[model samples]
Structures are given as structure tokens and as C-alpha cells.
Target: MTADEPTILATSAGYERGKYGIFDMRPGPIHHFAAELANAGEDAKFCFLHQAVGDPENWIGATYAAFAKTNYRASHLQLFPMPNHEDIRTHLLDQDVIWVNGGSVANLCAIWRVHGLDEILYEAWQAGVVLGGVSAGSICWHVGGSTDSYGPELRAFTDGLGWLPYSNGVHYDGEEQRRPMMHKLIGDGTLPDGYATDDGAGLVYRGTRMVEAVADREGPLAYELRRAADGSVTETPLPTRVLKYQ
Candidate 1:
């Protein structure tokens, strides 16, 4: 089950490919931590959404394998082939936690809006289902963020589900363009005051209010960004508590 109120874990953190298997995307310790955050009990219900990456088979197999050993009863919602579930809304709303994969934020948003998942997801969040992921998954919950979905060069994208009521910057430290672009977006009023996360780090929001920042690994951190009166941006570092697997 999820928390009593809406909980969002927006981050630039997710599975990593392992050399052992061709499609083994290892869900790191952060996965366990996220599950606990959702307050999932003995048998957790987890759902994965891959619309951001076109629901590639290789990635799907990798993600399924990632949850194979866990107590979670894992499933996925696919959009490419006419939806795998008969009632997408019911299936998602029943989930305790929903993890999304990163790919094309623009395309993901467009498709979700077309299929009415935007509303469905919002309903799930209101019901206290923990929703989150990396990159595109992270951006989808915010008002907007920097995206390279169009090309190699990053662009400001404001089309988001807006569950958190702020813009989000994913991979803030890993990508060189993310910081400056997000700064410009906030400065020019293209986006409102927001948060940014380095790789492996995330922002924890409870009911549209930021509660804390968390990281799977050391060194990575999250930031709060705001625009000054002179049209400049100021970033304040948020204390991050590193999470470990229980």
C-alpha cells in the first residue's frame, strides 16, 4: 500500500545494465528504498510504464528481470499494442508503486494525454500511489524541465502532468547542458521555481511540498532553484540522506 498522502520520488536514478546478461538492467538499492517509501507491505504491487521509451522489448525484459527476485508482484502497462490491460485506470489505481522508464518526455506526455493516462495517473497519485522514475519519468511529474528528446541538444519542455507543481531538472550533474538550461528556463519565466537532481539523487515530495532529498549513492545531491529579481538564478543545495537497502 502507499502512503496516506501523495508521495513523489523524482530523480535521475534508475536501473543500470550489467555485463553478465545481455538485457540485465540491475535495479539498484534505490529500488528497495523506494518500495519502502511507498509503504508497500509483505506483497507489494508494482507497475512499470515504458511509454517514454516506446516500450522496447529488451528494456521490458530487463525491467521484469529486475523485479523477478523481489517480493513485489510486478506488471507493466504497454501502449504500443493497444494496451495490455483491459482497464488501465483500475490496474494503475490498484498499484502500490508505479515506476516509469526514461526516454522521450514529449512523446510520453503526448501519448498519455491521448489515452487519458494523465488523468488516470493523477487520480492514482491522489489515492496515494507512489509515482516516480528517472529522466522522463521524473520530468513527467513536474511542470516541465530540460529535455533532449527532440535531439542531442537540450530544449525547454513545459508539457508535464504537473503533479508536483514545479519544474524538475534530471541528471543535473551528469549532463553539462542541464544546469544552464534549467537556470535560463527559471530566469526567463519559462518555468517556475523548481528542483534539480544529480545522477543517483532524487527529490521527495509529499502533497506538492518538498519533504527532503535522497540519494542512492554518495556525492550526488539535489538542489532548489529560484529566480532573483535581476533575472538571475540562485541554487540552494538541499541536504540529501543517502538510502541503503534493508
Candidate 2:
């Protein structure tokens, strides 16, 4: 219930795996990312949860392993692959950080509700766990998550973990087809209003404070989607390349 009690770092883009240099055990911005979580005072244990089917071989596991080698001193990193409903439990109370990977939001939500993972995550966040995720991982935290590439006729469910009241649309700038697809879906009454993010960008919320941070060392953009007074959907660009080492 206090400000800055838990600092969350959500990345819109997938975790970069190829020698990012941040997790290289050297002094730099990327190293600072690892340090931020590694240097957390007492009561912090990294819980890297991998989502989706191919995550074990994907960038998610690689990213976590890299972080573990350079930062996370904890021994165990939880791995949850596809159909994660049965794995959902209230045991997260013992963790100080929870990181989800990018994957199918529909499947994630389905399994989340079936096994009550949503409530567990909420409890973890309130308990001071630094909660975060990557692409699909970040979008699912919002309300009425975006339904762009998943098909117009097949709409994913609206109810999410509800970490935030608003919904988010990831890869707004990088995905050329997502913007128009989102507008069409919203106009057709398939999806509610939400925000969008660019590749290598982030929309982080630490407690009640929200800040936009870019992941890559170069160009990456973000956007916020809202309904106009005239009932029209609009996309507003967000500031990018604006964060520094802590």
C-alpha cells in the first residue's frame, strides 16, 4: 500500500537474447537493468516464470538464464509452459518478483482463470513482489486486452488478471498491421479502448507510478489508444528513449 514498495519493469518487445551486453557482467545500461533487481534489499527473490509452449528454447529462458547468471542469486526459477492453469496456485506469496514471458494471451487467461492465477498475481503484487512480463505477458495485465492478430471473428475473452483497470495493445509502432486492425476491431465493437506499445519499448507501473522506458539502445516508439469525445478511436504517441541508469 505504499509508493515504490515494488518496482515493476514490463517490456513490450520480446527479451533480446543475443549478447545484449546488459547482462554481460559489465558496467553499462544493460548491466544496470540486472543490478536493479539483483541489488534489491532483503525480501527479493526472482521468480522467472516462462509462458507459452516453445519458451524453453525461446528467448524467455535465455533471458532468465542470463539474468540469473549476472543478477538473480536465487536458485530456482519457476517455468510454466502452455496450459498453465493447473500450475496456478497461491504459493507466489513466497516470491519477491514474478516475470511472465510473451505468448498467447487467450491461452494464458484461460489457464489463469481456471487455476486462479489472477488472484494469486494480485496478491503477489500487493505483497510487494515486483511483477512484470514481456509482450503478451504485459498486455494480459490490462482489462479487455487487445484482439488484433488473433482474428476478428474469434475474439479473446475480456477479463484479465486486472493488475490495471485499463487495457494495453503491445507492439503499436513496430507492428504495421496492428494499428489498423485494432481500430477496425474497436470500431466493430470487438474490443474496448486500450493503449499500444512499440517494439523494445515498455510501459512500467511501480506501485501507482507509471513510466515509459525503451528497451533497445536505438529507435523504438509507443502509443496510447483512447476514444475521442466523438466516439472515435485515436492513437497518441508516447515519449521514447527517455530512461537512464538508476
Candidate 3:
């Protein structure tokens, strides 16, 4: 279900507790919104990328079990010692949606570069395969962002996929250290003007241009940060389209 135009949906949210699953987790409303954004059919081909978490096999199994209750054909691409798929590009481009899980984004980017997943994903993005994810997954698509990849302390991350020109901030409301770090990074010119999303919310981008902000529930929204002339950053709350939980 590739679109004619490229798309990326960055968010601070991920899977939530499910009433039906071996792992008791299911795709949230924001996840469904990603499927709709990709124009996925009833039986969607969803590929999960968990490079950030070292492609843990336990979560991979859980992802399969969770999707089994629904119609999505769940699959995962692992890059621990070697790539799980022979042709990584083909596997990614074939999916209706590629959902990335959260972890150390610095490690994710490093491993992706080693395996050439970065360029492969770039091709997938150009081919209109819906590319989106939460946390580390969210930050990977932007020019830079605040990441705790090094440790508990947050720092500016400049090396990203750069599919989106602006920086990105994830877990805006959930983490006390997130918002202020993003502000400092943008204000100091370490990162460009960017967007930040509170938990359960995301930003939709079409060909590098933002289309809208989407949330799975109320109160969780997105923010646009711009560095003002006097080394200050303005955070403007954007209108959010809340999705009804199915």
C-alpha cells in the first residue's frame, strides 16, 4: 500500500496494553492511524523494526502474537549479528507500514549504517513506503533531536536519517528532561527548529512537509518549536486530530 508520495509519522507513543494477546499488548489508535496513512487494507503487511532494542527475539515473538489476534500479517527485520532477510530493501518496501520500536537511537543508527539500512530505508521512503515509529524510531527520521542514548542524561543527537529537515522531540510530556533539552538544542543551533510530541501523539509528514498532528486520545498533542532571534525558543501547540479507539 505504498503511496505516490513519501510519508513519515513520528511519535512519542508505542504499543499499549491489549485485552487480547499473548503479550497483552495491541496496536493503539496512533498505530491504526499509521496504517490508514499508508492506506493499508484489512490484512495489512506490517513489518516491525526493533534495531533500537538490539532486535530482541522476545519482543519479536510478542509482536507476532499480538498481530495474530487481528488481521495484520506481522513480520520483523532483525540486524543483531546479521540481517534476518536476504534483501532488506525489498522486505521493507513490501510492507504496508514499517513500525520501529524504541531504544538507543544512537546504536540503532550505527547498526543501520553498518548494514546499510539507513540508505535502504531512504529508498523505501522515496518509494512511498510508510515509515514511522515511536521514541528512537521517531527521532531517527529527523535532522536531530534530544536523546538519552548515551545514558540517563539527555543530549542533542545530530546524526539522524534526515528524511525530515527539522529536529524531533519524543516523550515531550512524559519525560521531564525531554522538552527543555530540545529547546536548548534548537536555541543553541545544535539542532534546527523542530516538532515535539507528547505521549500518545504524533506528527504526519508528506514529502518533508507536515500535514497534521494526530493523537490517540485527548490531552496528548504535538508542539512546534522555533528558535527566535534573541536565542529563545517558542513552543506553539498545534491542533491535534484525536482518533477514536477501536
**Model 1: worst 10 consecutive residues (lDDT sum):** 22-31
Candidate 1 — which residues are off by over 4 angstroms? 20-22
In the range 1-246, model 3's lDDT, one tens digit per residue, is 876589998998777776754378877787777777778865778899989999888889888876777887888999887888998888888988899999999998999999888898888888878888999999999987999999999988999988799999999999999989998999999999989999999999999999999888889999999999998999999999998867
TM-score of 3: 0.96
Residue-level lDDT tens digits of model 2 in 164-246: 65666666666666667666655555566666667767766766455655555567666667776565788777776644653
What local distance difference test score does each model get?
0.88, 0.58, 0.88
Model 1 root mean square deviation, Cα atoms: 1.4
Decreasing lDDT order of the candidates: 3, 1, 2
Say which prediction, candidate 1 or candidate 2, comes out ahead on TM-score. 1
Q: Against the hidden reference, what TM-scores do the models get?
A: 0.96, 0.73, 0.96
lDDT of 1 at 232: 100
lDDT of 2: 0.58
